[model samples]
Target: MNAEVRVNAVFSDHMVLQREATIPVWGTGLDGMVVKLQFHGKQTEAVVANGCWRADLPAEKAGGPYELIIEAGNQLIVFRDVLIGDVWLAGGQSNMQWSLAQTDHAQAEIVDSHIPDFRFYDVPRVSYEDGIVHSPSWKVCTPEHAGAFSAVAYYFAKGIITELGIPIGIIGCNWGGTSIACWVSEQVLTHDDDLRIYADEYNEQIENFDWDVFAAKEAHYKEQIAEYDRRFAAGLREKELGDFPAAPMNPHYFLRPFGLYSTMLLTVVPFALKGVLFYQGESDAHRPLIYDKLLTAMISHWRTIWHHSMLPFLFVQLPAFGNGGNANGKEWPLLRESQLIVTEQVPYTGMVVALDCGDLEDIHPTNKKPVGERLALLALERVYEQPVESSGPVYKDYLIDHNKIILHFDHTGNGLEARGNQLIGFEIADETNEYVSAQAVIEGATVEVWSDQIVNPLAVRYGWANYTEANLVNSFGLPAGPFRTKREERQ
Candidate 1:
């Protein structure tokens, strides 16, 4: 007899299925065998073709502690404690991967994190297609396992479950220090002119890839990493620890463009999802000019693969960071502009403003509770159709009235207000294209910006730097993100 039928590893005990959506149960099985799936008083079947089969169960309402049974050729697989609810995929870089145990107030959060309905599934961090890896399983929210869950995802789910009282499943699909290029498909990257550069660079890097050479380098890298870990555990300061080890850029390298798309993302495709929560872009900030187009293409490609034309994609706007060096550089500001552009142009998408939640010196800020809760607010307002103020004041348009510029804004819940006594981070530029600090005052629903030095102010910008102390916010306490009226010539 051929091998027994197997359901995808994503389907396991304590798993939460997307409620009110067709739940696709898929796996590999013997060729020409019949596979059947039964759940919630519904039955579906598909014949195995090319060693694969899929049976989609009918949608159900948001309540379940049911069992899922699959049978193929006398082989039976049963998964218990399955819940029907909204499922979300959390995708991004280090901030999204930062575990709950490493976040602020972790001990208290973990102690209170015993919501049985909320669950998490961490996709294994596989870099290469042929790399042997263990299958990941779902974990119920408990003090023991919640500590290891993504802090951002945890808080987001907690907020949702608190309000809606429904099971919320989060599929953690993220890696630290990875560019958006690593998560998108090769076909999509190669098809675009600007994006082709990533593919070209990747091809060049792996053209002479050698397993033997890679093995030797990896051994050395591991040793160095071990020593670094020892020193870090020994309480050495980060600056005193010296440079961290860099892995060899071989074919199996994790940072290789399109590598995670094949190894990590593909493994979770077609899985039912309410939407995607993205928090990346730090690695791609150096090339801010192309980030908007790159992110738009990535969202479209992901939606296509999941077969959801208007799949909701809510992403975090890159937060304030000084990069441990220059805090005034325009690269980060430009990247934030690109992110805002994507939200403006793309439909069924939202962005969470984290300007106030960022750290001035640390790239990885410890205050993730606000970031995750803000994301939950967006999902509630945009996706779940809840009555919530999800965003702060966003710049709408501007008018030049002689020496002063009148700026309008939207989403100013109630009205916009400077968090402190006075507004800061506002600058005006004359025809000379030189920006100087300007005085801004909230005027009813709009803000008036002016500088005595510039009689003919041609442009205005707010919080236009890699790191800023912008105090503008709405009555709800959400901060307005950085913005500029026009593209700077130097940028």
Candidate 2:
């Protein structure tokens, strides 16, 4: 009598299941075996077919500490301290994975992080074709573990907890410096003409990779890391260590299409989720032209996989970085502009402007508190029907009159105001398409921009450069994101 029944490793003792959703509890059992699941005083059963079985538990409200029991003939499994609440998937690059210990005010935040309703599940960094090879189960949020947990996720969950008072589960599946291509499937890449190049390039790179050279590069990177640690120990902030050195190539691990997705995302599928908090785009800055398309494609594809076409996607727009001597010298600003396009064009999507939180020297900003809370504001307002402002002023429409261009914006929380005495970072261009510094002033919720040099202003740009210290913001103290009012034909 082989009556052994096993559930996915994700089904841990302290897991938080999505509230008000049909819970899909699946596992593998012997052929023709009947598996029964009991939770919240209800029982459901399923017959094993082809070595797999699933029981759909009825939807539950946002309250729990209930025990779940699974039985199959002589085999039985019990899970305690189960929670029913909002479960959010946190995904992206290094910024999304930036732990609390790495951020500002970490010591105080971590010391106070003793919320029992908050749970975390960090996916092991590994890529596989089949599924998650090593599953690290859910952990109860504590002061000790919170220090290593994703700062953005922790703060975001904290904000939601303060408002909703419900258990929150943040599942982190992020890889530092990974591109959006690494998260999507190969089929998604090959299906799109513009994105197919990434797949093709990875295929060629993998085929021609030299393991010996890669090993040498890895060794060199290790030495650099050691030196960096030594410098940090000598009372120097890690941010002062300057740019992180690029590591050796791992085509199959971080470069291949759907590499991280196949291993990290696939194993967690069919698990009900409230939404996704994404903070990527730094790695894709170089490909700014097609970023909006790629981002929309990723969101659409992810929704399809999750079987929730209306899944809410909240993302952080890239912030100001290194100096751009001129408008054309940097790719980051263009990427920021493209991010705005995705936020506006894509349905059920939100973008949090992080222009004010950027560090001029270091790419990873330490002020993750605002970024997290703003994302929570979006979810609270749009998803939970809470009355709150989730965004700064967003450019809506522009009207050109004589030499002046008046720009109108939305989400003006308590009207707009310049951070300093005078509005800055405004530029105007003529028919020649050469932008020059422009005088700008806030007139109600609209900004009037003009330049004496450009008699017939053809286009107007605000905070359009890579590292302009823009001062325009709403009353909420949230900085207005970058915007360019140039028509494609003019460029």
Candidate 3:
């Protein structure tokens, strides 16, 4: 007799199955035992193939709290407290991983999580040797369970729950201090020459480091322990900061990019989900130019592996943070532009504009409900198709007329309105290419721009800064995205 029954541990009570799509239910059983799955008025059955049986259950329309019963051999696994609705994968670094406990209304939110149906299944972080991952099942959302879930995912789901009234399942797979490259596949990194150079250099660093030599260095210091201890205690606060290069060059800091992705994403994460909600880029803010290619590769790699085209892949745009120069603050204008480029190139992709919600001092913004809520708004309208539009006003195009530059925007449902009474950050340029403060006034549905200094304006920009208090908003109450027209304003 062989022990034969395994369901990915992530599937548990209160899991939300995808509505209106082929649902795959699999587990191990007797070599040829017939597995029966009965859910939502459909009974599907399949024979155990190589001791693993998978039943493709017919699609169910968006609605449930229904039961899912699986029977095989002498074992019967019954999943209670289930629901049918939208499920999305929320992934990224600390921002995406930030817990509800860290948010503003955590106490109230956690207590309220005991609500009937919303669910989130968290997968443990584990790295692997291959590109394919098989992770465990999920945990339903409850007050006790909600304490540890991601705040970004939770708020996003809350917005969906209030609007859709259907159970929402969030698959959270995030890690703090993670890089975009680490989520990309090895093949993509190897294929691109620019990225390959970084990979080769990284592997070389790991290859050349001698751990024995490192140990010897530590051992050598052990002999002079008394002196070392005196120096460490007396006035060596600098050493406490940690040294990057111990033996002329650091070993751990130089590991290959995506080396961890191959190790973790493939080994620990499961591939089935409606789509991905990604928020990363703080690590690569310095290389804002390369950030585009890095993210594009990461998204493309995952989509190829999952075999889903036009998967509703959404991401949070980089929010404002740092005091001034760190992460190339002013340079971020270009990076945000690069993100727009990816959205332009890729279909079924949307960006959650967080430029307005950033806190200047702290890198991690505390007001997270809005961030999660905004992303959910996009998902609901675009992915769930709820009865509402989901976006701040977006810049569409512009017109140059004499000393005035007329701006046009998209999805200005009912028209544009400033959050405050006045517009604060619009800039216009003269033939000299010099930018001067431009005045903005709503002319019916478009914004008319002009500046005293820019008597012959050629281009214009709005709220395009590392820190700003732009009041531009659409009738939807969503702010307008930072934007600029590309003609040589002064030249």
Candidate 4:
């Protein structure tokens, strides 16, 4: 084995590389072989280090179906079907992490998709670090394999390939049922005073907690929750909302705040990507006030670490989950506002509305195409400089006309069109907490709203419940996400 040479990013036949930038090509080699990379008539060289060699190839403009030959002395290896194009990192929670196989039309989608130009690089679905694994192999797009990948990511890649007509690579690194905090770095957490307080405490707790006892307690809680679910399903309200309360609804992924963020920051955020696509907020809904700060911190922290100022990040507000319960929808509203605040605080960030894309009964919506597609649209318009209309009727401005409220919008590209029928789930409330059906008319750039009962309307809220018939879409046919804007901020 003295004269043998080995390579990684080697097993794959067709490799995708991002063009117009210096791509780091690194691997192990003989002690003094002088490893060289040859592609598209250009050759780059590097010296071996501890039996390894790495070099930054001069940036090449996108265009190619080329061959790459890596040589270490006389030992040579050739990687075929190399293409240079756009690479995107698709991340976030279950909505973003949902595989094509789980969506409504999985079978049909997977069967029809066979574009070979699109490739996927799945970072092992791990939240913790095993250190940096040097680049995963890119998988070619095929029906049998596409279904196993993230539905949102697959579709997004497909869209990009269809439009750009170039090789596209998607990096899917998302963990389901995880929160924003879990994806942050411990170093950053330690740096932030607002976060360090809890991080220190969590560290102490982890060190002191009796693992056996904690595990048993968690198991007990799960068992108890299961019993409550059985009771609730049997038409029993005895312990439905009363017994469970809020804390026990879901198991805490990070029993303490700042724990998750710190861990992911170091382990997950190393890859160089154009931007981020976020889909979360269901877990942090309860602490809406704090969420604004938390979200702002995460965005800032990510940009700072990546050293990319003004990175484009698109997020989705929480979709309606849990079978149409009596949830006042307070959390959802607060979280939406938090999302809005993030955009206002962080530059180049956008959001997608999913009010009409939720399951009335189940929390995880079966359709993920819209979520990912809308994200790509934002990228197309803002990132890729492609012409595309990618937003619904957004709450723009509000005018107080005596006791009436006139709500305006910005991106109603083709004007607002309520899906399938009437404008539902809109309520106008006065100073007193009393509310009633509000009359609304979509005209020009505004939706004039009012209710006779509240002639001096102080607030206007749309779809502020777990289950409200709210399907207001713009001419572009995207549903308006759930939101509430009052004359004064109540949340």
- List the candidates ranked by TM-score, beginning with the highest: 1, 2, 4, 3
Clashing pairs in 1: none
Candidate 4 — which residues are off by over 4 angstroms? Answer: 1-13, 27-35, 47-54, 71-78, 127-136, 193-201, 211-271, 323-326, 433-436, 487-491
Off by over 4 Å in 1: 1-3, 131-133, 212-246, 489-491
Which residue pairs in model 2 clash with each other? Answer: none
Model 1, 1-491: lDDT tens digits are 24568777799999999999998889887788999888989899999899888888999999989999988877888999999999999999999999999999999999988999999999999988674647789999999999999999999999999989999999999999899999998998999998899999878877878899878988999999999999878877435665568777887779989899988898888899999999999899888989999999999999999999999999999899875456888888999999998999999999999988888767889889999999999999999999999999999899999999999999988888999899999999998889999999998779999999999988999998888989999889999999988876434
Task: Candidate 3: list runs displaced more than 4 Å.
Answer: 1-3, 26-55, 63-76, 127-137, 212-256, 259-264, 267-271, 323-328, 431-436, 487-491
lDDT of 3 by residue, 114-169 (tens): 75667887766654343445555566777887878898998888888888787778
Number of clashes in model 3? Answer: 16
| Candidate 4 residue lDDT tens string, 134-191 | 5456678898678878887787777777777877877675666665666666665678
Give one clash count per candidate, in the order shown: 0, 0, 16, 13
Most accurate candidate by TM-score: 1
Candidate 2 vs candidate 3: the TM-score winner is: 2
Q: Lowest lDDT 10-mer window, candidate 3?
A: 241-250
Worst 10 residues of 4 by lDDT: 245-254
Instruction: Put down candidate 2 lDDT per residue, 1-491, tens digits, no spaces.
Output: 23378887679899999999999999787889889999999999999999888899999999989999998897788999999999999999988999999999999988999999999998778765544356478888898689988999999999999999999999898988888999899999999999998898778766768888888978999999888777767857534654456665566556457788787787788888999999999888878888888899999999999899899999999877763233234577888888888977999998888887877756788989988988898899888989888778888899999999999998887789998899998889988888899999999899999988989988887777666688888888878898888635212
**lDDT for every model?**
0.91, 0.85, 0.73, 0.71
Q: TM-score, each model? A: 0.94, 0.91, 0.81, 0.83
Compared with the true structure, model 1 gives a TM-score of 0.94
